[model samples]
Target: MSVRPVVRQLFRIEQLVDMLLALTGKEISRLQQILRSGTVVYHYYRYWWEGFEAVTEDLQVLLAKFPDADPSQAFRAEQCTAAAIEQAETQAPAKKMEVEIPREAASRKRLLRARSLWECLMQLAHENIPAYKTYSYGRHADIYVWEILPDVRGRLEKAVERFAPRELRAPLRRILQSSGALRLRFFVPR
Candidate 1:
């Protein structure tokens, strides 16, 4: 089935965040700050990698559905774009030399940290969970409805209908109990 592009992008970002956490054992607050500001260089690199994967997957699915079509022709435009990005990444210096060694060294240090973060995410994704499960989180208690039922959207709609501002806490608890949404529980102590 074709996934929505926005959902795919959100899933990729979630994966990137998970990878960052696994790699550095960094605080969630710091990661949230990085995502919020969109300033970190590594975030750009990770997003590029995820975008490449999404495009590649889209190409694969389209080709599978239409084997006779020249998929390469469709993908040529993206291929060119990917090539340009690769070239830019390769030519870009870790830091400009005119500043000083310390600043340049710091940039190199951050880049290395980002690489390690990416590696950890890859390792986690490969080890214990299916690719789709990589995007799952505890806060989204409604995810269980999607997992268990065929009519996920319908179930979510019903839940939203029954939802009330005052009754939220108890209803959420009941839903969690009924759905077993907390099965893959992991504790991250503050």
Candidate 2:
């Protein structure tokens, strides 16, 4: 077996590894953006929940204006009804429960995945090519700048910007700095 062919094979393998690292970094950045955005939405709902009590009270008062109303008939007839009022009240708690539980769960899962990817990127950064680490953060910035659907990303960006600093921002920034990607903007401004 010739040494030249073996060397060529090794070079190809190294290139392949490099490519995979780039892709992984990009994926990490994308996931970070997503996770951060999800965090924003979670907080928005939390804030909404905070105001929900007042909203429910107001709704109850509005329904009380029509004491003799059949809530189901009101809803079905586009008028106020007791049954519809009851149903709305009953559903409010369930809706709130759904919002709190699933949104939080999904947000947490996205954060976990993003953190795992960040850890992987950090590990890769410690290797010979540190570019991947920088690339990872840059890719996240790009997704925030581009790619992300505007309406959704706008709300997400706002939510993430509002919620991130206390949670993941500082740690992620420190990690990026440690990895030599100091110029990367991973956190949305508070």
Candidate 3:
């Protein structure tokens, strides 16, 4: 094979990578928009999960192409942009989960999925992109307070103890404290 063909192929691959990066950035922006929109709808839970899957797929393609292309800056920029949009669009009152989140077992399942997706996104951002400082403090703690805490109110300590991974205790306690909905001692060690 002539050097000319090899060079042409390399240029084509580079162009393809650039296109993929741009498309992925757009996907990330849309995902952020979905997050910033408002209360997590049951239907939207699947959407959010799918969005993360798309972003992961894009990241894989990017890594395959460059192996060193840090798209972290792109992700960070989108997060900021989404936050600004969210702030501007915040004129409407937050819709309470009472109506949106049902107490049924199926709804509870979806709610857990939503919480998992939130954690997954946070982990991705923390590891790959810049951290959102509020995430650790209780970015979406209301879900837990409104959904899980209510079911286990009488047995708060026991419920919290039963919760696995053990990392969720302290922040959850802080959220509960700040919320003023319930007063319970968090027995889990910090």
Candidate 4:
């Protein structure tokens, strides 16, 4: 439970993004174990916060590249209609059912959007956000992530609403809002 292993695992961009985007109950429980096992270093907390900020900023840039109208809407509407038709067909006795495989951005436009988003996300590993210096130092204290990074949660919401793909909007919000990641904040004392 040393700080180095914890930092290497948690502060990594790909791992962090995956944690944010695909957090599970099991993962949260594990993260809780990590948090409760060790005293979190102050500088590491700043690094962790900056990781989240980088994820959000990179997503914003990718989303800005999307066309004004979200291409996913049309596909979503088609899917709903297809589901209704399928449900009606299912009610009829003894029909052979055809399985529908979902495509993640099958069309060229969608593929492009997806690719750009991927690129932005990959770039997060290399990007750095300059941390502002804080002169005041106090006794070690545990602080809520939202409390210390006040406006960041709000910014994350705005980015999701404005730029996130239609499918990702809900899960991203739910996971980040309720996951163990938010509980990882620390206020380091010198």
Residue-level lDDT of model 4, residues 1-190, one tens digit each, is 7554434444543443333322221233443443344333343352244211233445445334322222222111212111000111234447423222122321112333434222322122123221212211121111111121335445545544554555655654564354222221212222
**lDDT for predicted candidate 4 compared with the true structure:** 0.31
Superior by lDDT: candidate 3 or candidate 4: 4
Per-model C-alpha lDDT, please? 0.28, 0.25, 0.29, 0.31
Model 2 spans with C-alpha error above 4 angstroms: 1-146, 161-165, 169-190
What lDDT does model 3 reach? 0.29
In the range 34-105, model 1's lDDT, one tens digit per residue, is 555543344323342312222444434432432121212211111111000001112335621111111111
Off by over 4 Å in 3: 1-151, 182-190
Which residue pairs clash in candidate 4? none
Judging by lDDT against the true structure, name the best candidate.
4
**What TM-score, computed on C-alpha atoms, does each candidate reach?**
0.18, 0.15, 0.19, 0.22
TM-score winner between 2 and 3, please give it: 3
lDDT score for residue 173 of model 4? 57
Model 4 off-target regions past 4 Å? 1-120, 128-155, 179-190
In candidate 1 the C-alpha lDDT for residue 5 amounts to 46
**What TM-score does structure 2 among the candidates reach?**
0.15
Model 2 residue 123 CA deviation in Å:
28
Clash list (residue pairs), candidate 1: 19-121
- Clash numbers, per candidate: 1, 10, 0, 0
